[model samples]
Target chain A: MNWDYLLSLFMGGLTRGSIYALIALGYTMVYGIITLINFAHGEIYMIGAFTALIAIGVLTLAGWNGTAILLIAAVAAVVYAAAYGWTLERIAYRPLRHAPRLSALISAIGMSLFLQNYVRMAQTANFLPFPNLIPEFAFLKPVAHIVRSSELVIYAVTALVMLLLTLLVRFTRMGKAMRATAQDRDMAMLSGVDVDRVISLTFVIGSAIAATGGVLIASHIGQINFYIGFLAGIKAFVAAVLGGIGSLPGAVLGGLVLGWTESFFTGYVSSDYEDVFAFLFLVGILIFRPSGLLGRKQMEKV
Target chain B: MKAEFKKSLLAALWFMFLTFPITVVRVNTIERTVAWRWERLIWIGAATFILSFIWRRLLHRKQTGRREVSAGEVRPPSRWKQMAADPRLKGLALSAAALCFLVIPLLFSWNKTILVTNALIYVVIALGLNIVVGLAGQLVLGYVAFFAVGAYSYALLNYHFAVGFWAALPMGAALAAAFGLLLGFPVLRLRGDYLAIVTLGFGEIIRIVLENWNALSFGPSGIDNIPPPGFFGLALTLRQTHIAIYYLMVALTLLTILVVHRLQHSRIGRSWEALREDETAAQAMGIDTTGAKLSAFALGACWAGMAGVVFAAKQKFINPGNFTIWESILVLCIVVLGGMGSIAGVVLAALVLVILPEALRVFADYRWLLFGALLVLMMVFRPGGLVNARRRAYAFEPSAPEKSERP
Candidate 1:
């Protein structure tokens, strides 16, 4: 492959992978803390996209400019998604904490189905065009033909959010509580940390980040459907696992790897076999290193 | 107050029933016929309920003089005490087995050959899933991926290579098993929900490949005119004769059941149970946990492959949509509802799941609602399944010379 073309492809993969990484963090965080896969996270992403779409529509109706509309929509999407995520955990998952894992999984599946079909029923099954809120500036026009201004915006937004998340996790008191609860819920409870609150807060933060990713993806793609999250969610989950399920930075690394592999497979081989390649890679990694690249191998207590 | 509550409830039901027709008449022709029939059925159902209540009361009054016995408790028989004392319960079970062998085929109408064939197909799938979910305790969400592989393998091989059905059958199973091994290598380490998520991803990936791969899968139009099985020189197709296919399916189903039953009682089965109960302990016990897990995956996929070939032959049309996530979930539901490790339970569960929907065609829209409710209720009340697998007692006999040892 030509070096320039390969470089561009790599960059493209990184951009896409960053979005997946953001979503994967949500999965990894929840799994790390409670050992539960927040199956409804995908729907939270969907809700985020819709929230942005609605926000854009309302802003446009009131004759807001592109910049103002984008800012307003992003904030609204994050807030709405965070609230929805919190509510879903409270209603569907909270009561089932003491129940069997199978029951919780079933309930999660049910909630996912309900959310997906509900959206399908409310909105037309067809893809709706996202608002062109981000302006196209020629800042990167000299460097490459492939990189669009919209893509640059996506990269910037993702980087900013990730930085903020890192800072929050590293320094904040709430973050400490969240980390403590994740390490050992019983111990955290004994130490005066409200485990339930920490868990809820974890969901809210993760969902907010996922929502941000959703908005960026929608803005980049220009159009989105109700079922868009199904594949992306799976890929993100893969990314989370590949990066070591509970590790934050691992999610990012796994996302990037997955994205690059997918992009390269589609670019060189066939788009049809893109998933085949990705899963094959996953299987290979899992067999060789079950703890993932950065994850510590957990020992089971009998 | 109870009597008044009952009367008011009855009045409310009656009023609603009467209003249902006027509402239907106001709508279109299709709506009217459906509504009218449903309302009339409700009225007839109420009358039957009243009659049954009266009959039950009379029966209870007539039987008042009889001694009452506790529910599900039976008195020991004096005549058969010697046989019953064996403790194995095998002697007691032979009669039930004989009754089942005689009644099942005769009780149901044989005219619905298609239903029997479908049930057989489900039985095969249930057995296949039983290995992964029941034996291995690995929750697989993309089981239909193997089925699709098997179907497509047959279709592609038969059409391009001009291979016969018999040749394609084993080839298809092998191909699916290979994929299962491939998927299992990475995911075998993950447990519970994590494993489930990965498998779900795998299933979606397979479907997406099938959908987008225009060169191979023909992209949505799907492969048609898949040839039927020909034994020796006789060509057996759905159009010519369904009985042959029905018999073939039944034979295959029985073979599957027998194999699974044997496997469950075998050393390998014990290993699987060990893994399910405690993977660490099983590993400590010198069981090759990884190998056992992979075997379960391979075996499960192999069964799914066999079922897929049957499905493709029966339909004579194979497509990506045919093997979907929903189908996988349905198979999983059958296994769970049937009581995971029990063969007879899954068969019965499959029968109910398949037959119930067909029976409730009139209320098609509400069928899923009913199913959802039933699932919740079943999990709540009868989570162990209809026929639970109880522990078999030892058949050892006690000697009558304990006084010598004491002395």
Candidate 2:
């Protein structure tokens, strides 16, 4: 047991988990409401990364520095990505709402393909470098030696986002509408909850959060590409499932656990088997608790 | 006429805009972002406009007034239906199809013969998948895993033990069946999306194993110089080999159709249909849900394995890349697009999916994009598929209804 090695892996896992948690939050929220996997969610994330790259490039020309530039770029990315998410829902999903679940899933998959190729065609298939924008934090050296400023930024941003999301869901009228709609669409409609608006809002918010994750991940990885969103999206979806899909806390927990599992597996076992192990874990979870770690066991209505 | 043209123009522009985000290239490596190709958009728009008018006049006129019967309903007799109803006409049509298929290579060049051969292979794959997803109502996302397993089994047996194609054929299928059982047991409780993902995971695991286990699979480089199957004891030249494989694929495809058609009429077939319709009701009526599910899995795997052996034999090489999720997605698309549980639909879909893409040639770069978009569009417009399988209109009634009626 190398304490130093373990500590580094743990820190690395935490940052990775934060990214997964961001993406998982979107997956869980959308799934909770409509029960569609939103296969395009990953592509949305990639688009976010690309948008951020373009934004940073423009901002850099405008001679902005440090946190101010990062903030503006991040906001720009989130807004653009939220718009993409909303459009996708409107075009691909809303039309197929009354259709079979398989239809929506297929639509999502199509949207994903469309978006991935769209980006690949628009942006170079080659990896574009993302700017490092986080300011140095001089005070964290004593508390955790392995923690870097950018990583610390990721942790803080993710925590802040989650807190804000929790507040939004708990306190806001729209949040209440979303929760009500998720609970029972018919009943919610009867109660004057605009289920349609709530679903759209869910997509909007989820995409925004996923965008934020995309920015952070791009910064962390120091590069962005068309293909980045897929594997990350899948792992995050698995995490969302692991935590019990449709549960916010479950998604976060699952993301963290999945991140840690990969890190530890990579550290202790063969690195080549990381994805294999993650997939196996997903299979195990599916076999044992199909509802997931915290998912409500659904009853088949006669 | 103007309205239709306007509609076509709008559709074309929409497609252009949809392709815009992916089509416009931006590279910042050395601060250069140039979007190449403006004329392609014009080509697309022009093509769509021209084709839309032709299709509207030629094809849409005939189908414009046909009643859209839901799946499982017995459609009213049409020209095709009337022709199909006559045994003499049906036999003649079948003979014509067989004859056409046989003479296709002779009429076309060698490239087309190979393409048709590949299309024939896809038909076999689609038919096998139809058994699980279409007939059994189980969506197995990792269906390609079985196909890959079959190919590997054939390849490895031949490579390691000098086992010829004849011996390896059954061996490959059996091994694939054994794997299907192994993977199917744990997922018996799962349904729909859950079953899909687990199967997908199972497929990925198998792929990873094949990729990593260098000694067995030769890793990513793939095994080459694989011996093609012989005609009993006769050796074949390259040209003759292509013809032999083509006919071999034809025989196998026909064999698959016969087996599947027969199975659909058997006692077990009825059980699968019941299981597919409503698992809970089927179980309540003592349908042995797990047994039906496993059998479907096994049988589907068996066919996929046989296809795999044929594919390996034809290619004379095997690689892990040949067995990717794309392959699974392709087969699944065929089953879904063709109309689940419709044998003729699967055959039609297999031809359309394989032949159209291969024939187009230029759209090869956008293959997955085209496939994915078509899948989504198909689902949206025709959820039941191109030829939706009707509810069992010719099958056994469960004893419950009969017992209640008697009482």
lDDT for each residue of candidate 2 in A1-302, tens digit (9 for 90 to 100): 67877888998899989999999999999989988888889888988888777767766765666788888878987987888898789768986887666567767767887788767755667887887887666797674657778888888888998999999999999989989988889999999988889999999999999999999889877998898997888889899999999999899999999999899899888887777888899888987888888889989865
* Model 1 lDDT per residue over A8-86, tens place: 7887897789889989989999988888887778878887887777667656655667698898888988887787788
- The DockQ assigned to candidate 2 is 0.46
lDDT of 2 by residue, B128-152 (tens): 8899988888888899999999999
Clashes within 3 Å, all models in order: 0, 6
Error (Å) of candidate 2 at residue B353 is 1.6
What TM-score do all the candidates reach, one by one? 0.76, 0.89
Judged by DockQ cut-offs, the docking class of candidate 2 is acceptable
Return the top candidate by TM-score.
2
Clashing pairs in 2: A118-B21, A118-B22, A121-B22, A122-B24, B72-B390, B72-B391
